[model samples]
Target: MSKSEDIVINWARRLQSLAQAGLTYSKEKFELERYQEIRDIAADMMAYKSDLPLAKVKDLFCNETGYQTPKIDTRAAVFQADKILLVQESDGRWALPGGWCEAELTVMENCIKEAKEEAGIDVTVEKVIALQDLQKHSSKIFPYGVLKVFFLCHKTGGHFQANSETIATDYFSLDNLPPLSVNKTCVEQIKLCFEAQADKNWQTRFE
Candidate 1:
């Protein structure tokens, strides 16, 4: 992320925290409105600095009331032969084809949907590969807390179809994987996923 993006994110988080604190501690409606106005200012700052539009910034920040929650991201580790499926994103980096979990779908279903949407392949989730808590790791990419759930999947059907989110899809050996999108998929997490695939006794490792 750029320096401007960092500033925008930090401002938004601070504003959100302020709003939550005000709502929880103060009973007056006027005070709540004041804090909400501050959040709106923070949203404006984000709109000025980030790629997101003003409406999107407002929806992401000011519209929320109390406590802010981290999003749940779902991914699948689909192995074919001895290689694993990876996607080349629009930014020209390879990453596991996955995204934020949708509200209406179960986690397993979301992982399947992401595989199709991002990699153009249908897959069945066999078992959870790993449940990683991003907050525990001191990483610059996921500074804002996130929970990543990786599932060990088997290819069911469908041809590889790359979409707008992904430019190409290919398989890679564990040691020869391309530069990955660290914010979305990290090397340690991928190793854990592959390890789970190799171990039958390791049911699921949640961290």
Candidate 2:
């Protein structure tokens, strides 16, 4: 995105945050109206800069309550031999099996659940291998802040099977990967997971 577009997105995010806070804490009706106006303006900014419909953008901004924070995305980096597990997503590109963390879901539980749901595999989360801020690593501007959590998982059981969001599952060597969902799990990050798996010295990387 251009610097001007960045400015618009940043301004819109800030305005949305401020508006949310103002709406949450302020008791006065006039104050509430002003906050609502701020939210509408923020949504307008998003709509003007992006292809999203204004009404959808408005709903995204206005539907939630309280402080907005980075949404967590849990991922499992499961290895079979020297290959990594990658699931064919609904969008056609492949990615590590995982999604938005549900209420009270532990990292291991979420990882295991996602593995079963998307890849039809049972996994035991070995450890958290990486924690990343998606905006820092990705070129696309995500509508909400995202905190990506990747786990090095141990495969236990189950076979490749299709699910609602995933069409297929397979393991691929690091040297030869399938078309990847770069927005979710990229080649560089996948390489890091491989390295971490091979060496006990590999430390958890964070951003």
Best by TM-score: 2
lDDT of 2 by residue, 1-207 (tens): 899999899999999999999999999999999999998899889888877888888776567889888788999999889999999987889999999888788767888898889988888877789999998888877567889899999988988777689998889999899999999899988998998899877688997
Across 1-50, the per-residue lDDT of candidate 1 in tens digits comes to 66666666676667766776676677888997897687667677767766
Best candidate according to lDDT: 2
What TM-score goes with each of the models?
0.76, 0.95
TM-score of 1: 0.76
Which residue pairs of candidate 1 clash? none
**Model 1 score (lDDT):** 0.78
| Runs off by more than 4 Å, candidate 2 | none
> Cα lDDT for residue 29, model 1?
86
Q: What local distance difference test score does each model get?
A: 0.78, 0.88
Error of 2 at 101 (Å): 0.4
